[model samples]
Target: MNDVTQPVSRTVGILAGMGPAAGVDFVRLFVAACESWLREHGHPVLDQSYPEHWMAQLPVPDRTLALSDASAEQPLDAMARGLRQLASLGATAIAIPCNTAHAWHAALQERVPEVELLHIASETATDVERRGLARVALLATEGTYGAGLYGHAFDALGIQCLLPDQAARKRLMQGIYDGVKAGDLALAQQCFTEVGEQLRAQHGDIALVMACTEIPLALPQAPAARGWTLIDPTAILANALARRAYARA
Candidate 1:
């Protein structure tokens, strides 16, 4: 799925900072993927290409904000406001790289009706359905579980999603919060690998979805992902944005 680009100025609105580090990985993916895209096409190393207007370093949600269900409205408001601001700066399209933040997607879309948003759930679900995988395992944060936004997409596609047990879910969520988001790469890696191991031990091939954008940063294509098919939402989101940009061209 590699091709050369004609080098156009593209602005991607990134609504990020669901623990900040995950946000960084999303931007890095776009740059590396696009740069690698150029190099693969036999183009001179593109130096002035990513004209993407990114409003990074936005005020991060505190523990109270992210942990509280009642605080959902505020963060969604902040995200919508951020997108509106970025759109004013000429962002042609928008993408939110955070999975948990997607729980409030309804609210955000309702408030900011003008910007075209690249949805991870719907687009990623399309890929999952194309693979003909009926039963899959989801590994994400508490918000994703509590909200079931990803689950809604899979359900609509008639896919069955299996989640980790409660204890495992707790450790995994903590891994996202105290580990990966905290920059503790080792712990994050351990948590994700352990979860993957558990899923594989079920004695059947299980499709694993890294429903959280922060996941692949810790649990990449390693031993844990060897037997199981790992679906990355962030990569899917990036490709969706690229295709949308292409269609507009």
Candidate 2:
């Protein structure tokens, strides 16, 4: 069924507005996942189902924001407010798509303790350990860098998380918010390939967690890797979400 035509159940709360593109990615994943779930279980796919809710009708594809070191809390507040909004609308749980904003998950949880948050970082860490990857490299923003969000989560689960070196980090920061987040696909691919190659040189033979959901828009899963496996948090989270949605269905 097309996204527009799907039957939406209770509203799914999404605390978005971190980097607009990441939020867009999560919604698309949610709808597409629902349909994929439907087909996998032999549920009938509708040719068209008018969305009877707000999130189902958010009319835009690319809502990307340029991120910086300054004012991270604004996005977090946006997330919390959105969660409260969805909860008021009877949403069962809330999911935030941006990895960096996950730094505020604890606070958000405190604000809306009744709403369940699909912890992408926590889930990704578990998956990293489950895959037997002891040491993995991460390519995310400075916020995610300073927060040590993934490292703490992964360490708790017996996995080691590595950050890019200073020089690589500088390039990565420029590459993401400037290049990829700006809708420059060509530039984005350039940035991803550049960062990927740099990471290979600096630290070889490790899984590179595309911690930033926006990173995958640049690095699609087509060309096979020689020494690195791209760990996509979006796909990982999607699988986890699908499992949850199905188990409870």
Candidate 3:
């Protein structure tokens, strides 16, 4: 038996499955980051040395519907239950890779105040500030756009968030729903690239924030040469979780 007073091992709980694919992708990215971090620090880069984590792929009600329809079942209770499950399993911190789901962040945290809920928007906004990026384009779902979650975070940090106009937003929605979500990677990539190009042309020197978890799956990671920095919120959140999980006293 282990000593109760000994420092507890850090365990990160991943609340995912909003689209299923993004959830799985977030886990893979996190494990890769952990491996990279372990190797760089001269630690054993074996799987056993990596941080303990639980990916709770809950089948919660649709967040977009909950936000848009007044009568639709809210995801708050379901999300809270997922967090409680993680806490019950000894997870110290929780990370949700979905930006749209963060609309209920305040209420979710209120329900599970004992557990740490990492904010993706706030973290990404901080990165924007750190990189001295004054303006950046946002590519996200209609629910996220309506919630203004990213807007509030960026505004708080004095960073300008550029969003898609109505027509562009429609194209983005089709790319995500008809292309990425529908398992047509090629179509999705083409649509995303076109939107990015237009956004870049309209707003020069602006970085593109793949605020939607699905966008990262379709968007090219090496688009820096195209005059736009692609920021993946999943990467940002994953790295943060790794830090908290592997932090040395």
Candidate 4:
């Protein structure tokens, strides 16, 4: 077992670039969280306030295509290589921002057992439990939904995971792929807010799980507008990483 009590001055690995934008957003959140953690604990902001992070922005094959098509190149090898690269750089822990990529998490862990890989969905589910939330809505790619990655994790924690309807799911996908991935923030915001409204109306006070990392980036307004909370897995994962990196100090 790793002694987390030791100083975590070592590098943290970010297994990212599944879609590129989401990966960048995740790292930005991590940086912000580190700054916030230091300030909240009465530590003045300094140049070395944050841990060194190695970003392995793998040009891995498309996760959805790889999952749906039998002949498509599997992303397993590329993802494994990224994890191994991080371990080679002596990363104490790793964070994969993409939810769809998490489908290969177990195999990736097997390839790099020395470091810890943070599970975004599991961390989000844990947050839901801590907040005493019974049910939450999922807004993610079709690949993530089909894999039941978030659903299974939330279920194990006695939380009900609500999914968008077919039409709503399609809208969410448009926001992720055509909007955010394509670098059209305006369109992404439009699609995200519209779909969020639909989900909020249908579910009636249910919190939303931004299972797709890009969703949070594209959100137009916080759920406070609807008197509900939108759970951001990326933010949760980043904050968790910050805490783990500084816990011993």
**TM-score, predicted candidate 4 vs. hidden true structure:** 0.91
Q: Where does candidate 4 clash, by residue pair? A: none
TM-score against native, each model: 0.85, 0.80, 0.91, 0.91
Model 4: how far is 136 from its true place, Å? Answer: 0.5
User: Is candidate 2 or 4 superior in TM-score?
Assistant: 4
Write model 2 residue lDDT over 119-210, tens digit each, in one string.
88888988888888888889887768877878888889877787777777777767677777677766666666677877777777778898
User: 140-227, model 1: which lDDT tens digit per residue?
Assistant: 8777888787789999999998888888888887767777778887888788888888877873678789988778888884565665
**Candidate 4 global Cα RMSD:** 3.7
- Give candidate 1's error at residue 90 in angstroms: 1.1
Q: What is the C-alpha lDDT of each candidate?
A: 0.74, 0.68, 0.85, 0.83
Q: Candidate 1 — what's its lDDT?
A: 0.74
Off by over 4 Å in 4: 1-8, 221-228
Root-mean-square deviation of Cα positions for candidate 1 versus the true structure, in angstroms: 3.9
Model 4, residue 224: displacement in angstroms? 10
**Candidate achieving higher TM-score, 1 or 2:** 1
Which one wins by lDDT: 1 or 2? 1
